[model samples]
Target: MNFVEELRWRGMLHDIMPGTEEELNKHMTSGYIGFDPTADSLHVGHLTQIMTLIHFQRAGHKPVALVGGATGMVGDPSGKSAERNLLSEDVLNHNVKCLEDQLKKFLDFNSGPNSAEMVNNYDWFKNFTFLDFIRDVGKHLTVNYMMAKDSVKKRLEGETGMSFTEFSYQLVQGYDFYYLWKEKNCQVQMGGSDQWGNIVTGTELIRRKAAGNAFAITTQLIKKADGTKFGKTESGAVWLDPAKTSPYKFYQFWLNTTDSDAKSWIRIFTLKSQAEIEELEKEHDLAPHLRILQKALAEEITVRTHSFDALQTALKTSDFLFGNGSLEFLNSLSKEDVLEVFEGLPQFTISKDEFSAGINATDLLAEKTTVFPSKGEARKMISGGGVSINKEKIADPALILNTENLINGKFLVAQKGKKNYFLIMAE
Candidate 1:
């Protein structure tokens, strides 16, 4: 399939310029998608634009990733309620470097002529004086034209009104495109549908300033079928940074997707071909509860965004913790993997000599740990067979915790009923 057709099937195409397909078919063209440097890591919300660049590069086009170092400092007001806090230059530079490193994982920067390249708008905007911008780039678009955008309209109508900095955000972004177009010979700019005004401003600027023809494409902002914004969990954003979110938690986020969202997500997120997605869809129809789509989507993205080893370990850890894997499975984990997967599990810290010498089960589960909070509660729950240690029932209130009962000679897995888990670690 052609680039447009591939995107159409993948549910990616939202708006394409009039002659985009014809232009793409003639020769390899350069396309770019801008990303904000608001944080050190990109979130799942940023995947849509990344996928668009992936598709563009896959179709033999050069993909340029524009890091919005300058614009991000001002913040884009699309779908936001209030004025944004400005970022320091030091922080913005750090964010740009981090984002560029992440982008390298997906795009092929080593390939021939169509190799992907990274650029920063701050490079061009840093030295351009205020008077120079007003005379050169800002003269093309009228205030009336700027205020007509949905982003502007909402802010103007709302209680917070708008800041001159936020209002001028599009012009700054538009200048990024113009710079890329004139300097890099970049032909197309792509972003979410909400960026249409800013993108068109670039095209309009190109026409007025350089008498150049430039095109723009915008993809629909992904949304959950259940009506929540995509890329958010109750805890907050699903970050690409391992330090912010572990690979296991990241894997689980995709694995836990509802049936309806998974079906659509696989198309937009995965590089799986049309036929492969169809087969998975059929497999899903046969047994919707199996959730093959969610698993596949999760696995592909996890492996690509993280690593194959991470995905493999996540699969093993999930099976060990929740599936049929035995207690020996937990015993086999490296210290790091055990701690990573069990980061949120309640933990009790105790001296090695204390646990090794002798620790009473009831006291350990109560005074030593936050699991039960009291000796009476620990004893009552243990008597009812509701508390389990290392996947086995703990019934004796006087039972001792020792290396013999420890997994990997250092940790104990405590479970309360079917869901709650706690980890007790020897210091």
Candidate 2:
């Protein structure tokens, strides 16, 4: 269970300080990765760092999950092109607590010797005065040294000059490492490739301030094979919170990974052994149309991030929508669950009074709603056996629908062909 080797084999290793591997191998060293509370819920982009910590702990080392309550206020400028709007204390506190709860799900916090622990920088930085920080932290790094960082250098060259607050962000974050090192005996700091400069600053602070050695390692930043940003869809980031991004959508996000991206992500995201992944890849190659790789990746991740039950529901919903299962499955689901399953599909609303009176199927699809452009077109599709309501084929153009036809008494699931889906909501 060599941590460095594990990351290397998975193509996750990006930057490692000299002797980092030796330090990790020598003993059960304590290591940590910091997460900022920039949002109430973490997105898929944070999964890599979460996986890094998981691997660190799996290798029989103490893993610490640090929440950047203090640094979050200042905001890390690592990959940002411009300044960000600051969050208030109440909002930031809420976000920190939310993120802490999410991180706890990925690691074993109860195991004895090498158990995971959560720490908040705000706990210490809350009472520290600016003057004290300048004397203790700012004194360790020179302005020239700080300005040399790529994050700082880039901001200086841009029209919107970097602010003093952002410039000192690295120093604030470095102190967090120093504090953890001095207090928790955390030996190594890990993060995404973009945080290399900030991480090194911490190690340097340890050496120059206390003549102590600290190690750094960074994993590759996840990106799409198409060169677009990872973890983002047209709606925005794919959030970890089921409330923000439903389990179905979250599952679909990974299920939709491109073949090339799946080849790489399967290694980084899943804890499957090399032999197991290789076997899956071989099977996937045999039938690319089956999307075995995408399915494996999605199932593993969805189960871990959400739950086995969630994965089952996502699968059942997928099966029903894709035409592999019957409408009875939809009928078996609760009204809320049914709506969740068809979240992204087209939906139309009709007055409850109009719906109770029972409308003609053709009128419902053509006039009352827009499932088809015209009554004639709707009739033709119905005749061709290409249309369905509540999972049953529309038998006649004049067939009536009303409250009795509504699943859970509020909705009707309409299907056009095998793929196109529409939801008719009666309120």
Candidate 3:
């Protein structure tokens, strides 16, 4: 399939300019997607655009990943109720570098003709003065045309009136497209559905200013089956950076997708053939409990974003936490690994001096931690075979836990029931 057809089948194509597919089919055109550098790390929400650029390159086209260093300073007002607090130059520069690094992971930079290229709008905008920008680039679009955009119109209707800095964002972004088109021979701009206005502005500018044609293609903005936002959990956005969101948690985010969402997401997120997805759906329907679709989706994305080794560790950690994984696995891991395995579990801390002298298990579970409300409950649970320490059933409430019981000399794994896990730390 060609680039446009591939996106169409994947349910990614939302809007396309009049001659986009024809233009794409005619030649190996250079296309670009702009990524806003609002944060140091791009989250899972950015994956669709990344996938778009990847698909573009896979179809034998040059894909340029543009980090919006200058446009980011004037935040895109799309889908916003009020103006965002602008980032300082130092912070914006840092965020730009971080986003560029993350963008590098998705596209090939070493291939012959279609290798991906990275650019920052700041590179071009830094030398151009305010006067130069308004005179050369800003004159192409009218104030009435800019105001017609839904992003601007909505803000104009709302109580938080728009700022000149933000209102001028589309013009700045339009100039980016013109700059890339004039300098890089970039003929197409791709983005999410929300960017339709800004993208068309670019195409419009290209036509009026440079008297050249440009294409615009936008993909569907991702949302959940329930109509809530995608890429968000109770904790926050599912970040691509392992430090921000661990591979295990990242894997879990997709692994826990609803069946309906999984069917759609598996296609949009993964480069899996349609046949493979259809087959997986068949298996999933046969035994919904198996969650084959979710697993496949999670594994592919996790491995691509993180690594095979990271995915393996995430799987091992998941198995140990949720499956009938052996305690030996936990024993073999270091304290750091153990903590990662039990991350977000309820934890209690005690001074090492107190832990040096043996403490009664009941006292430790009750007074020292919130694992149990009182000593009586701890005693009863221990007698009832419902309590365990390091996967070993606690047979005696009188048993004393010392430094010897501490895994890696600083941690203890406590269980109140089969699934309720707590971590005790001695520092």
Relative to the unseen true structure, what is the C-alpha lDDT of residue 84 in candidate 3, on a scale of 0 to 100? 89
Better of 1 and 2 by lDDT: 2
The CA-based lDDT of model 2 is what? 0.93
Cα deviation of 202 in candidate 3 (Å)? 0.3
lDDT of 3 by residue, 321-373 (tens): 77777677777778777777777779888998888998999999999888999
Local accuracy of candidate 1 as per-residue lDDT tens digits, 1-427: 7778988888888998888788888889998999999999999999999999999999999999999888988889887899878899999999999999999999999999999999988889889999999999878888998899899999999999999999999899888888999999999999999898889888888988989999989888999998998889887999998878888889999999998889899999999998999999999989987888999999999998999998987887788678876876666678887888797677777888887798899988888877887889889999999998888888888898887787777888888887788988887
Give per-residue CA lDDT, model 2, range 1-427, as digits (tens): 5999999999999999999999999999999999999999999999999999999999999999999899889989999999998899999999999999999889999999999999999999999999999999888899999999999999999999899999999998889889999999999999999999999999999999999999999999999998999999999999999888889899999999999999999999999999999999999999988999999999999989999999999999888888478767777888788778888789998988887898999999999889999999999999999999988888698998889998777888899998999999888
Runs off by more than 4 Å, candidate 2: none
Ranking by TM-score: 3, 2, 1
lDDT of 1 at 214: 90
Clashes of 1: 0
Which pairs clash (backbone N, Cα, C closer than 3 Å) in model 2?
none
- Tell me the number of clashing residue pairs for each predicted model: 0, 0, 0
* Model 3: CA > 4 A from native: none
lDDT of the structure predicted as candidate 3: 0.93
